[model samples]
Target: MKSNILTIMKKELARFFGDKRLVLTTLVIPGLMIYLIYSLMGSGMMSAFAPSEDQIYNVLVTSPSEEFVAAADQLKLEITEADIGDIDSIKQKLRNGEIDLYVVFPEDFDQSIASIRVGEAPDEPLELEMYYSSTEVNSSAAADIVFSYLDGLEESLSNLFNINSGSAQYDVATDEDATGMLFSMLIPMLLIMFLFSGCMAVAPESIAGEKERGTIAALLVTPLKRGDLAIGKILALSIIALLSGASSFVGTLLSLPKLMGGDMVELAGIDAGVYGVTEYLTLLVVMLTTVLVIVAIISIISAYSNSVKEATTYITPLMIVVMLVGLTSMFGNGAPTNPVLYLIPIYNSVQCMNGVFSFSGSLINTVITSVANIAYTAILVVVLKKMFDSEKIMFSK
Candidate 1:
């Protein structure tokens, strides 16, 4: 029994790995593409978050006071005074990239501060409104700098009045919380994508390509049981998909520091060592079962198609659904507490991974998801076996 399955698996593996072009496109190219794409995205994010060193910021002020003007000059900002009525035009200029930011000081702004300094409170609090285009890099940087300057001004006024605002409070988030946030937000979605891409790369060729080339008819005539052939094909495709997934996984881990703004110490505010042995084990279990499910789905789709192109076309909708399901982690707080939801296949795997990463994992749900996935794959294998036995499916024109 084992010999037949092994023979079939070996045949599939040899057929895949023996071809240099297939190996390159399936294994090597995916990792390389992910690294390049993610690195470029990270670089773009970094550039967007900061302005160039030589960039000069343009500023417009309304009813500027002597102290405010001094502050602007100290910061080396180019200041222009516009009428309050020109606020709309200034905003339009900001949107058009003609200016970086605009600041508006309330009427009697200096008098309000004077009252406060003389130990008399004003009837209303003094207010300043700064407007800037967040979509523009220079505008965002200028806004941050101006906000810092305002904070300093506020601190100076507080010191002049001897006002005590109490001690500073630091962030209370622990390493675990940060790690959970990062993992829950990133890993589940990425895992799903990688698993699907891996399976998509190979499953079509294993099933649909063989059908298209009429090689499946040759295999069907052999002494191998139809069930054995189905299992062997699935098992072989799963292994290859797992390797492809692993390659993509490694690429993501290596480029994560670059992806998270080039800071390895902090990812979504979490440091390394957030995940331990238990977390890794949980991830392994979820990933393995998830791969099986993905492979089964792809294999079924490929078996139904007459050619690799048709197989891909059939699987595209499934890929979109998987991607959409993976995105739930981004918006959800964590895994759902309901155990019934754990039986929902791909969605369950995603939520379970999210739960495990966030420290909210339920062992019961994990077990259920794993078992359910295997059970579902078994049903799919039965369907595939039937498809294998059908002459119309195996040798379709």
Candidate 2:
């Protein structure tokens, strides 16, 4: 039995390595994708830091206070006066890349404030609308700057009215540890995204490519059990997946310092010692889980695909979903709750990763979650072998 398995493993590895494209599939393509995603993200953040004059922010003022007018002028913005124009026009312009912002001042502007009696000069809050252009990298940031200035205007107008904005009703209760909230979101995302993307470069092509070349049928006759064949393929993919995870792990770590740009928050909770212990242990578990899930999914996807092209097309949506989940996690969103969460496959691994990063979650949760991921992997192996055993999959178009 051992020799049979070894023979299957050796043959699978030989097939993959025999292709000069293996290095590119297993590492190069994944590395490039990682670089592209991280580069775009890092550049976005860097743009926020670097001042540029070409950032010509357009503003539409429905009604502007003297001070609001002055603020726009000082910023050298092209301020256009429009009242009750089609909101659609503004949106259309935004879509066509015409304007960066829309600022509206209510008619009661000063009257509402004076009537409120506290910060009364005008009751109306100057509403600044920013429409972001998906194509423009800085459209969102430009909107942020516009809104920030408008918010300040609101505060300043109150001060000028001699109205105290402070309400004496105090709701203050301190003394809680909230340091770990970040881990609950960001770590899970990274774990999910890296694995999913890495799989894209290998899984579809590995199985479907062989089938396309009529190579799988030849291998099926080589005295290897269908189960071992499935495992051997999964094992090869797992090694490559582990490498991708490790590379991404190192890349993200290296980029954090740059991404944060000397921020204390980046410096505060993380270090080699901390990662080497808790984070590393958790990351390893997360990675193992990710590989299993990805391999299973890929095997299923590849089995149904008669060609690599069809497989890629079928799996692209899955890639997008994985990316969206990962992106959500990057913003600190995914977290684990019940034992059922641990049983939820890919999402559970991310939740555990987040818990590990925060250091507030229990070890029991981690262990249970890890076991669940491995359990999922085992089940997938059975399903994959069933595919291998089927004559329909072997010969079907």
Q: Which pairs of residues have clashing backbones in candidate 1?
A: none
Top-lDDT candidate index: 1
Candidate 2 wrongly placed segments (more than 4 Å): 15-21, 32-180, 264-276, 324-334
Residue-wise lDDT of candidate 1 within 1-397, one digit each (tens)? 5888899999999999999998998899888888888888888887878777777689988888767777775676788997787667878999998999998988788777777777787776688999999999888888888899878767766665544466753667788887888888898999899999999999999899999998888988888898898889889989999899988988887777777776554535665477889878988988898888889889988998999999999999989999999999887687889999999999999999999888888899999999999999999999999999998888777
Task: Write one digit per residue (lDDT tens) for candidate 2, span 274-386.
Answer: 44465666778777877877877887889888999999999989878776756544454334457676676666666677666655456777777778878877888898889
- Model 1 clash tally? 0
User: Residue 109: error of model 1 in Å?
Assistant: 8.0
Candidate 2 at 246: error in angstroms? Answer: 2.6
Q: What is the total number of backbone clashes in candidate 2?
A: 10
Q: How far out, in Å, is residue 87 in model 2?
A: 28
Which RMSD does model 1 reach against the true structure? 3.8
